[model samples]
Target: MSLEAQYLANKLAKGFVGTNQIESNSRLCMASAGTGYKLSLGADGPPGSYRDFEKADVFFVIGSNTADCHPILFLRMMDRVKAGAKLIVVDPRRTATAEKADLYLQIKPGTDLALLNGLLHLLHENGHTDPDFIAAHTEGWEAMPGFLAEYPPATVAEITGIPEAGIREAASLIGRAGEWMSLWTMGLNQSTHGTWNTNALVNLHLATGAICRSGSGPFSLTGQPNAMGGREMGYMGPGLPGQRSVLVDEERAFVEELWELPPDTLRKDGVGQGAVEMFQKMADGAIKACWIICTNPVASVANRGTVIEGLEAADFVVTQDVFAETETNTYADVVLPGAMWTETEGVLINSERNLTLASPATDPPGEALADWQIIARVACAMGYEKGFSYESAEDVFEEIKRAWNPKTGWDLRGVTYERLRAGSVQWPAAREEGPDRNPIRYVDRDGELSFPRASGRAVFYARPHIPAAEMPDDDFPFVLNTGRLQHQWHTLTKTGKVARLNKLNPGPFVELHPQDARELGIVDGDAVEVASRRGRAVLPAVVTDRVRPGCCFAPFHWNDLFGDCLSINAVTSDAVDPVSFQPELKVCAVGLAKVSSPRRPCPSPSSRLRSSTCTDH
Candidate 1:
């Protein structure tokens, strides 16, 4: 079905002239990291693997709360830490992960680039770089020193709110490590300067020759299962199957040849609209119809008012999901029930590039079908019979092998469904290379260095630090941030229904500093109305020092389904990075006021988006 979705998207793009609008939900989460990886390392997947974590001498975790978000990986990291590996954490909030850090820099939000550049500057100053590696394996190194000089410790400390001594100590720790690994997620990716934030981190690794090795590399941890596979399958708007881009003629030709299509079967224009732009176009009536699969955009997207408007304004909307009562289904003209986890058989590729096949243990209820089945059925209904005629999941998997371009060093031809059913396998499973699948990337089994770039060398990007799209003013004095809780998953479609999980994390609340709460004349559990330039939401205030004084935090799990106007996306900024188009959901300016009861009624589903007001009951 994954192959069918890609096939149908390509066909639809070919049929529709002058517009290509196929996109994936990863745009909201990992697009910045993807763009950054391609820009600096010449490809998207991590150069190092999870095996590196065990052998690492130092671990640098930024932007992610790994303890709660990725518990199993956190356990592995802790195991390494127990064996004498130093752990460094950088975040705006002093999270549970930070609590265990050997060195924790609780820096200000959205200032990752500044802090990273400062560390790189210090690394160079302290003579920690591998000049030999840079000359041999990397390119564009001569231009970085001058740009890095702009981020001295003093300036970075001021920008990030971490002390100068702390900054220097962090650099020294990273510089002295025998082998270090960096881990990050949406905290760095969901910002206006997200791409540069990633670029700077890669810059550090390249400077120290910390990548393409056993115990060191810059690893972007994905929050979702199969997100890496989705990218490999070309789910991004501008992509074709096997990470090929429509913008590149040779890559397009390869896919066209594999699919047995004509020379110009795929669209040749620019990359298609990202999620933010896609909804904006739908709201503008440029996109007449949309088919959303396995995602709830209304609850998850920043500037969700626009998403709501987009759904309401579109000529037709189809939502294929496992749950019937999703916030997105209210606006969907056609609701297709998709099979749940154990009810469907498919393959999932996890963060470490491990491919695992899941066999169905139970049948789907009612008329529900697998996601791919739904796509193939729709394609056949639309008269694309021959292309969509795949007999089984194994047949689609076979075509996926053909879709891979060997030149990219991501050969999947050796992988068979039979092999996958027995046990999991990491990718770059070349037909010629026998059973051993190397977890590490960018190098051959012979340990030869070869980047997939045009120059066959990893490139260094001279990127600059930029502030968040919206800064706090008197009207909106506090910086509002959103993230996940330990117990609940995204928007709580599944976990919210679990009684134990609900008991662990009962409901959503606004987390502010005790100082801020005192200043606002509020107490713990007080109903506080937080209003941003975009929209507003009211929740109980949890007064603590988990977050910095000038900043506040909220979990984005609750939505209208749980209560009236509980969606925290209402208060998030829609500003996106120009390069990656990933929204800065991590930072926005919002004001807080104590409320007695619900001051305003929750906005109706059919309400105009410009109103920008929401409520909780």
Candidate 2:
């Protein structure tokens, strides 16, 4: 963690005079995973690393469209598939990832918990569960089987819309597999039942001793590259570095002494705002000055119209990012030019917990600065001079090492800047271990059980299924799902500038089932307007069979800054999971309309775009 952020988190939490809050974009993408991981195993990062991908015989890739978002990791999975590993993809859309699956369970949206419980029911019925392991290394495992009784194949099939036979077949594949590695992303995390979705997936591993094995565990593929690092460094609310929480007295005391601050620097009586709630506080005039860095939340946050209104309502708003022309900067009171990825040097921790040092390939443009440097300057300006004087990125690295204390079990003392610059290494590699030593978690395979939980054992959550916060009705007759395109990165701040990339997906478009399109009198190039109770988006429509009949897909990458088109989040619902507070961005109800514009339809990037380039599925 940066000293500036740590100090402020402490101050703000303590309700120190003149301080209000410190929030981040971390809550939007990984909050549910974070909450579930901590609840299940009593920590942030997952027990399994990417190395498990190489040793596994069965890969359950659910919720995530790995082929689009984490293309490199998906390539590795494909290598395993070719080597005879069976792949199972669970999703509502026939995504690129699902197309490669040995079994694609086209589940009903928001019914993942039911499907997972149904798997456990089958596992128990077939006597595939590992009672010895559960008895020895787990708490609450005895109770899970009883809960699974309510969700038999027939019952789950009714809710999930997957055939009962398909459910049984999937259960058999997962049950009898040599090793299992389960993965998911936004599709599971961005929903009202996100935490439950995650815990339910984890339940499978706990039920059958599928975790902590050489190639077995539940893995949440990070949407953002350094999301794991951000969590480890206490970027979220109620957090301190080393996976410590402010709510814990011992952890709070450790942080207080680590920074040599007054005992009251961090508040005791209140919790800070998350991303979704922060905007609510802003609109209600409870917060004054708001600062956003790195993320383009204006175009990305669920309910785009409301978030922009909150930004506008702030007394003072600051946006620090690479682009000067972003929709966010349009409303900013001050713009701090942040250096782009190619123009900055720092460490990025990927989904697997590997610490990778990214070196700048070119100098930053005029007046722009690295993210950390900008933060340091701002801290000094705010009169925190002593700790804010960082000479280089390595200075921050040294501080991070200090913050990664032994007690945290994420001891990174061996991972020096010099060693990291040469290669990456996973966390928990202590100084006694070599600098290059990589680590996997939870040593249960050798009959030695270790969970990060206070009980010294993993906990199985009997979480129940909950429907999506918003569902389609007569007024809003289709479910609107928003996500990424293969060639276009989030918001397209950098990729949109590429001519070749533009030739792939030229503008904003919504993908609906051809049956729904035909029923609504829409065509491939028809201009359409999709509306929700919150807002509306106008874009070109793509009639495809990839999405289910009542569900539609829209790429969340385009906006006025990129193609002078609509942002999908405008029509996305802001309803959030009560536990994670992450908006239900993946599923919402919207009505689609065919626009009768007098102007000619924009030319398709090429005829093959409908086939080759539309990776939205």
Once fitted onto the true fold, the runs of candidate 2 whose alpha carbons sit more than 4 angstroms away are 1-20, 405-408, 432-435, 444-447, 563-565, 570-617
Native-to-model Cα distance after best TM-score fit, residue 14 in candidate 2, in Å = 7.7
Model 2, residue pairs in steric clash: 10-265, 13-266, 13-267, 14-266, 14-267, 95-617
Clashes of 2: 6
Model 1 pairs whose backbones collide: 1-372
Q: Model 1 clash tally? A: 1
Give the C-alpha lDDT of model 1.
0.79
**Candidate 1 lDDT, 1-617, residue by residue in tens:** 34344444554454333346777767778877888888888778788788998899999999999999999899999999999999999988888899999999998887888999999999999999999999998998999999889999999999989999999998998899999999998888877777777888999999999988999999999977677888777776777777778888898788777766778777777565578777888889988999888888888877677788888899999999999998899899999998876887788887777878878999999999888788777877877777678788777778778876665677778888888877888888876345645778877769888888877789888878776666766666678777888999998998999999999999999888887777777777677777765567777878889999888888899987887657786221122323222222222223334254456656755554545643221
Give the per-residue Cα lDDT of candidate 2 at 286.
Answer: 84
| Positional deviation of residue 367's Cα in model 1 after best superposition, in angstroms | 1.3
Which candidate has the highest lDDT of all? 1
- Model 1, which residues run further than 4 Å from truth? 1-19, 570-596, 606-610, 614-617
lDDT values for all models: 0.79, 0.72
